[model samples]
Target: MKLTKREKLFERIENHLRITARQLVKFDTEEETLQYLIDSSRSELKCDFVGIVLKEGNYLISKVWSGSCVSISESFPIKIENCSPTFLNKSITFDKVDKDTICEFSKLLLEENILTWFTVPLKDDTNTYGFCIIGFMNYVPLLDEMNRVFEEFGKDVAVAISLSRRKEVQKNKMMGVEWISQNLTLDTEMDQIVGKLVERAGKGTNAQFACIYLYNERENCFILQTPAYGEKTRLNKILIEKNYVLKEYFPYLETPGGPQLTVPLVIDLKTIGVLHVENKGSLVFTKEDEEILELLSNHVAAMLENARLYNNEKDHKQRLHHLLDYQQALVKETVEKDTFDGIVFTLSRLFSKTVMIFDRFMRPISYELFDVAEDELHTLMELATFEVYQKKNRDLWFSVDYDRNMGVWSVNGGSDLLGYLAIDITGEEIDDFFKLSIDLARNIASIQFIKQKIVLDAKEQVKDSFITKLLVEKIEDEESIIQYANLFNWNLFHQHRVAVLSIDLLEEGTKDNILEHQAKKSLLWDQIKTRVLFYDQDILFANKEGEFILIIPIEKEKEKPKVYWAKLYEEIKKWLALEGDKSKILIGISGKTEVINDYFIMYQQAVQALNVVSHRFSNVGFAMFEELGSYTLLHHLKDSSIATLFIQKHLEPLLKYSEGKSMDLFHTLRVYLNNNGSIKETSDELYIHRSSLLYRLEKIESLLEVSLNFAEHRFDLMMAYKLYDLYYSNTALT
Candidate 1:
């Protein structure tokens, strides 16, 4: 039916809102519905301009608009009272600009050449969402009637806004679940999981600020897991310093600015971390929003915990597999390979670090450098000193460097210390798995060392037997001795000299404990053997109970054997001197020989020479059998009981008489005999008066019941003096 202009406008408003309400429910989000409503009002409802100002806390935020001035109409914020059901109970129409309508919302319409406008509260039975404003540039009749119709239309728009938001919320919930199910797997990294978690939380709750903070148990603090909306550094500092204060506001905290929701990512009654979400713009978070985020947090926490478990299991399996492979390869390499290179190479590859196998002296036996520079290796080698390792406990892994980035494990072969296994830990974190891998490697190294030691010890036994038999002349055939020496890679047929080294390792009275003494002796012997082998590895060597036998090959006969022996003696003396003054090394060398059977005789001569040096030449470190002169005779008589008695019979009388006396008669008599019984020579050599020397001589002659004038008495006394010098002399005659 045809009606007046006011009735016609009312009918048009009803018809247009009815059509727009259907389309509004079709849209999925509130923004889409709001935009369609504004567009329909401006085009079909005969309005010059239309805009929606949604209530956000105590302010009205111009959300959407449609007009020529739409760009300037959107996002205009005006401070206002909080929205309530009774706050804007009716449509308020402004026919002209006045002081009551001179606010920011009116200014926006004035800028659009809209002189007339009315704002109606967008509300339903339960809530007043905001206001819908319709404006016109010119005045019109029935403006009050049009405002009434527009008020009714605004209710439909408010209901549409609510339905669309619910639909979007449901969609986000489904999408969040789908994202967790599809994207989060055992293989997902923690960063990816946390990133997705934070993004989904923000979307599900319509939050402008969202972040996840994972707890670092080692650091005892919360580390921000994803990029946060606010100042990340400031948030982190606040969270770290005031974690308990933040925790007191668990679930949600409403402030004057806005509302904040905090939900912990809990699993099995334990909180691993927290999920935080703040409302966007001027909106406030509801209890329902808190529940949604909490649900998401639960799922994410489970996923995070599962991911951690999966990674841990995978890492353990990998480490165990690597350990098994290392063990198998170590066994195979120890059996088939001749050295430790293969083992260390495999270990370096497994750990992705530089690996080294060092001997007891901290000398690297085998090493594999993976991505290590030569200069860095040199530094590591220099830092790994014998003194450094010796100060640490053995058979355990420990940080060896000052930076605590290097680890070393001592390898032990039963009672013997084999070596060490070391790795560079810089820029890496070491877990129990890492330690376990190193422990397995060192244990394998110990086994390899023990295996090698077994072979070496057996070879040493066979070599010792062969050498003992050769030295004692038990192997009668020279050909047999030559074959035995060849077994040790020695050419016994060459011109060689035998050297007997007697080591007086300890002082006369040092340690009374036998075990400690033996241990020190063994250590010293190892040092000496290592030094000698370093000098010449091909030299034939045998270890006796009290001495070490070395058969030194003479390369050139042009130089006298004494020259070669003198050089060797100086070297040995120098090394022994380094051992300290308490230790003395006396080397006695024999003349060169071509015959293998003469080796036995050379050994005897060398021993006799060592005995002479030990007994008569207390000031000397080495001596040659050829250089012994008359002292060579003392070798046989030195061990003879008859020689000892004869020496005691002559020298004992003189020794007993000279004691407590002003002049030494034994010294005078020996000088007299050495001077060919020339009285003047004896007196001059003695640096004494001839009368004093004669008195001492007469006393010696009377004590022996003989006269110095008789040759038999002088000869017997001379022979006795020679024996006395060989057996009884402690120092050289000065």
Candidate 2:
């Protein structure tokens, strides 16, 4: 096959135009640029086929084709190494035809007829973009005129494409800088700015959809704010693929579709987000589109940061104001008495939920719109004790949920646990309100504690004053003492015993005079109650009369009644020593009598005994009975000497034998006495032989030189024994 000059010249122009268009269109952007280049080349070359294939790394895709002879498959992927010209030429070829190259190109083109083929590498300065192919049914000879024209056109196209790309790059850079500056100055926040930026970028590149999917480094996932058309609705419906391309990459790039493009939003060299542009019209995005999207991504990254900062600042200011208000409330002195109730009320009103104040123990103090029964309060109090209180001075607010319905705020006053506040903010913003109220309540508690201390001190002083005056103004008249006793609510009707105590103040000196007297009265009262059951007794001092009155029951009106007198005397003496100074104090015990009307008799008797002991005795302190010994002595003697002598004379024989070491004699006497001097009982008690017991008794009568068998002798002996036992016990002697 031979080619005419006219045919060669046209083919040269066609090749030149295709190269020119390829350079004019950015490979990274509009795929249509390649198709347009193929169309123009096919029209001028008058060939059976012309097509442009694009290389992406080692893989080649037929980007554009124009020919009636065959249709280039869009989906078929070709390896750069397997392409015809890639194997044929290790160097540049000009106006040269080769059998292997032609055959390889023809096969790829699917041309069955004989043909000549020409292939050119789409060489840019750095690397091959792709290749151009032209096919003819007949072989053609290269003409000088056509070769010159082809060389010149190819050179011009290459320069034009390179220049066009540079121009496009500069334009994109300027637009990106302007967009960032404008976004920074706009009132829109980072999120809104990024959304709008991506949308605009999509529109600029004629994309079907756009989205700014923010990258969460912590989560290592993309978070798309505004999903492309139907994407958000389909998110749940669509299966997330392992390597799902962004929606904003290609038009008509559906499920199992054509090529797509995605640009990462890199700021500071880190991918913080992605810019997605979808071309739904079989439009694969070009390099220029990628460059523009990348520039837009930078602006989006900055805007996102700005928005985050703005939101943080706004939130910080809000928290600051809230804290300030809380602090002011804490310091305010006008705290409602029912702080818990007030908190509940305020919170319920503010947030429309029930609120409660609890102590650190989580015991609800007061509550609003809640049925807090006494038992519940107690239970809450018990729970509250376990909770920790955060100090009001510090910025610590702790919360806990005791149950589904119960929320607790552990209020504090510095490090010390004050108490807690609780509320059932079941459906409210409880967190913030509780913190504020609990702090306020803590401050209130501190102030209340101080106030209570002051009040307690004042009450103590008042009590001291009252007691001092009461003790000092002694009433002398019986009626007056009774009236004074009545003031203390003492019962005066029943028989009572008066014990007078004269306390000698310690040499170191007493405390308050009133306190000392009060202490004495208290001690006396305590002792009397502890020792005896004074069901109805009144103790009072008769100042002018100088007597202590004791009124006691006299069941049998008898003279010289001894048991009652002795008991009264001993107990009074002990009481006086315990209440007063043991070394220097006089105590007087009045006789027991049932003389209600004759109060003066008792008073006089007591006073006389006290005076007699004080004035007559040289002792620093003496009991009354010790001074007036007339009746006391007669009582002692009656139970002593006469009784002892009578027994000794009558039982002299028994006594002498007992003294002379006859053990049986003492046993005999004891048995005889226990048995009322009956010989039969005496014999039984001694477990003795009867005749032997009678013989011992006879000996006892002989030694005593008295008749023991006589009643009078028996009585005398009995009295003597009683007297001696009493005497020995008192004297602590055997």
Candidate 3:
């Protein structure tokens, strides 16, 4: 243009800026754009070196530089606050290299043979990005116009840097949106989503490191996704804390390397995971970057939560379908086949666990074992008792051992407990699915029990009617008796004893309400029946008001009748003790008989023996008619007036003579007869001196007119005393 030097310089700066602008459009990154500006400035501004240091956070980091002083400029990193005033906002020119007169920025420039140089603040109207320093090796005059032109060029550089950054930020934002739309979805696998999420977050935000930590509810810890690129120690610290606020940079997260930002993937106000990015290129994380990640995190949380719900729903549907199939199988097998074995097999197949059904007495009635050893099954069955099963409520699980847990539900038929439905769980945590399935199975089992109970109850009515006629001598026809007995698979022609069992509450036990009392009685009777049946299947039984009458056939064995009864008595007692509560169980047995007609008399004898134990023995465990010995006569004559008159005639006089006396004459007579009339033995038994016992005996003989020295008189007195002891153990002397 043939203008003055000032105009020419200004014109050259404009041309260079135009060229840089065109080049800026070609480059994409901030580094590329800044490098072009530095290169153009060094070539057109006639400088030995040019470098641009931008303010990033609180420091002025060298972004790009060109020319001969590259090593020196690259080494002299600058903090904005630590820079000398000469290298700050205003342009400063130096005539020559003078280390003593200048700041470190100029001193470093002079060391590279730069005698004349100036710095211009690369600033827009709003703020300063940083300063651009231009150094010349040879001397050059700092013309005001050239300085002004360079300053304008510096402003152009700041605008270009700002535009490039805006482009990068916009591009990253779009990339994040596209990635979220494409990858984070219900269709995506969680592993794939999380892995790509961390990598994409780091790349999109211009951060060197990124991580995604998913929370595990079961373990109550965070699980780091695979292939994570980040400071795991710092990420782990945040995870351990678990107390970070959403979408915020913790003050303590700031480090010498860079600042860190964490945004939790929250849903329903609960943090399911977190999106963490650190070292976002040389700058602190901006609110926009955080917002972008926050949006992405929120979407991820929603997707994760939705996917979880979807999967749970799918699982629930499958579980319901399985439970329905199990129920149908149970109904079909238990109702159509009329067996509990099907129930056990079905449940075992459904749950892949061991299944056992126990009758009301805790005896295993039906079982299907799966992957269980014989010894372990025995141990498990042993653990399954009314006592232990009752300790936990129905349909709930309790640990039976370290590796096994058990759940039991009572199969109830109306007011009676039919059985228990039990399942053995090994090495698995119980969930609602199992509980629901077991509950359904128990219901089906209970229904089947009720049906069986209905049929059995009809049979019981007929048996009870037949037994009543037999016991009351109503069925005198032997053919009718044999026919009825044979119907139940019983051989009544054999010699059998009638054992009348009476169960009552212990005197010391708390009195229960009527229903509770009956329930306990029913439970106790079930236990007794199970034990007795195990002993002998031919045992026939019928329930009366408060007792159970059994027709127990006497087997022809070497063991005596008393010994057999004793063993049976002990077995019943063991069953009672298994309840872990106390009760009175009294059994009265009649003498063995072969005649069917004599069954009535034998039943009477059993009743009499039971009465003796109830009244004379305070309801002791058991008594037998044959074991009663002399008491059998009393049992027969117990209701006779002659028996009463005999006891009165023998002991009434002694009772009258011993009135108000410290030494009882009637007691002395009893002791004298019990000791075989031996004076010393009688004295020892009475715990008295021989003379004192003789005096009482003489008084008794005088009152009753009995000779103590004669055997005939002693025999009469012994009979009288035996009668007295039998009828008058308590106060009433019948």
Candidate 4:
């Protein structure tokens, strides 16, 4: 098409707009660039009423008006859709509009008598937001040269908007990168980092208020740590769930009472927590600001993660060192009968806490204090046990109410609890010093447990050795044995019974100084004599090589011989197990012999029975001479063949059936006899149904060809079973 003068003029204006866009890219701020575009366009496109009416929806608002026109608000609405086809397409147009189209533009436009208009759409690479309309009050002919200039001007205007947007984006991206770099350089201490972030971000964005809500993994919640306001700031530690709702469009948005922008602190696409910047004013946050904050949050999250790891590692190292030192101290000292006070003193010095050591029974053994009073200390100890030690959970460091005034950080070592260490951190720094100290306390508690075990084992060894030596050396004199027992601080003056047990030790060296010292210091044997004698007198009291002899005295006349023997045997076994050794113990009782002179014969008998039972049975436990009957004398005689013949003839069926796994026939026989042949009682005792017990009895009757229902037969069979057991059991020992 042949171009008119007016078309030529529009073309020149379009080219000028593009040049202006390129120039606008150099400016940093949005307002400065926008103003530059308006001034440049008006001066270049010299004409009356050369006002740049920046599009405001369906109405045009004059941003820069050149000639005389009534002052119109910058935000006046204009209906550009109906005004020009070119404006709707976000293109440039020189349209001759009639009164009908003018009226359609807007009611305000009609009232202002806007007849003709030229419009250029202001757009970037994206959709055009609005158009730049130039209104002419009177109609003018479209001269060919003018048409060219106007067309060129429209193109320039499009180029200007595109370049301006590009520059703004580039500037924002650069600033974002800088902000992230600075954020990462912040320290790992969360409060310090949060403080720095809030200060820098608030000033940079000109925000009224700012806060950094850090994620507390333990609580599984976000805590607002750094508030721009003072300590009384209502925003600190606000939970995300209590305050904000998460959304895909914008995770942060303005709420009912405030303008809030929350960006998730994300690392590796995982959202750790949210960072919130809020203002009470009506200032709307821009998209660019949100992006920048998001970028900053990313750096903050990564730094926080690193800081947490660093703190954990440092604490672990400190704990390891404390444990090593504690273990060394325990190994060097004798801790057999350490009081709770001694334990507390040791541990408190280790971790710098007021520590209390409790046994599994929840009794305080030792405690150490700084400024706390005795009653307060006792109360704190009880509180610690109730709060942390009794609980099944293994929370290492927690808070405990201290006299209702302050809360102390307590570290617990869980049930069968090794007690707790409470530090008065009322005035300490909230950093590595506090965390490391708590960790060290836990380590010391663990070491204390190990030390206690070691001390107990040592005491047991000394007692075992003392009894074994007295028995093997034939020191059967009660006075000599009593004197030897005195070496372990066991009193023999009280009414007592001597028990001898032989246990094969695991190691070559039987002498343990810790055990010996514990034996000398223990009050367990204070009122009663406990002498542990060994088998080989020449063997240098090695815990590994020989049998142990135990002498236990009962101070009470009411104590039964069998009952005391069983209790003593169990106690020894438990002590042995704690030593972590596999030494089978064969225990023998001398009955409840009270006379000091009789202890010699009783000791020989007990030792003899121990040897007999250990040699006869694969698993030997406590054996009493009084219960052995004739076998006690028979065991000393060594008549193996005669004893075997008697067992094979009378108890053959019971033995064979028991060996063949037929209802544990031996055990059934023993229980049946023990219940005095009462079928109902035996069944109840064995937890077996009555019918099953009857069947077993009937089977035994048939096998033995004896009617156990008769009193005479029952008596004969019971005696025979007892005799057979005695003969074989004793003969095996010989």
| Candidate 4 TM-score versus the reference | 0.49
Report the number of backbone clashes for model 4. Answer: 74
Best by TM-score: 1
Candidate 4 wrong stretches, greater than 4 Å: 1-30, 36-105, 108-129, 132-154, 168-483, 500-550, 559-596, 604-734
Model 1's number of clashes is 0
**Residue-by-residue lDDT tens digits, candidate 1, 455-512:** 8678777877778878776556767767788888888778888888876655654467
Question: Which model, 3 or 4, shows the larger TM-score?
Answer: 3
Tell me which of candidates 1 and 4 scores higher on lDDT. Answer: 1
- TM-score preference between candidates 1 and 4, better one: 1
Lowest-sum lDDT 10-residue window in model 1: 230-239
TM-score, prediction 1: 0.71
Candidate 2 lDDT: 0.52
Task: Kindly list the per-residue Cα lDDT of model 4 for residues 1-734, writing each as its tens digit.
Answer: 99987667666766776677568667765556657766776577544455455543234445555553454433344445544544544434345444365444344445666565565555545545455556567665444444444444445555555565556667766766776575545345656666777775666555677776666755556666654532233344544455445553234542222255777777887766666665634344555567657656755678866766676777678767866777566434434534445545665676565665554433455666766677776666566656553443554333445433222333334433444445554454456655654565556566656566567568667756555554453444557666666766656555555665454444444436657544432322321122122211211122313333345545432456666555655665664564344555676666655544555566666656665465444365867776766656655546657655655655677767777574876678777876888888998888999999888888888887877768887666665555555444444322
Give, for candidate 3, the lowest lDDT window spanning 10 residues: 248-257
Worst 10 residues of 4 by lDDT: 527-536
How high is the CA lDDT of each candidate model? 0.72, 0.52, 0.72, 0.56
Q: In model 2, where is the ten-residue run with the lowest total lDDT? A: 230-239
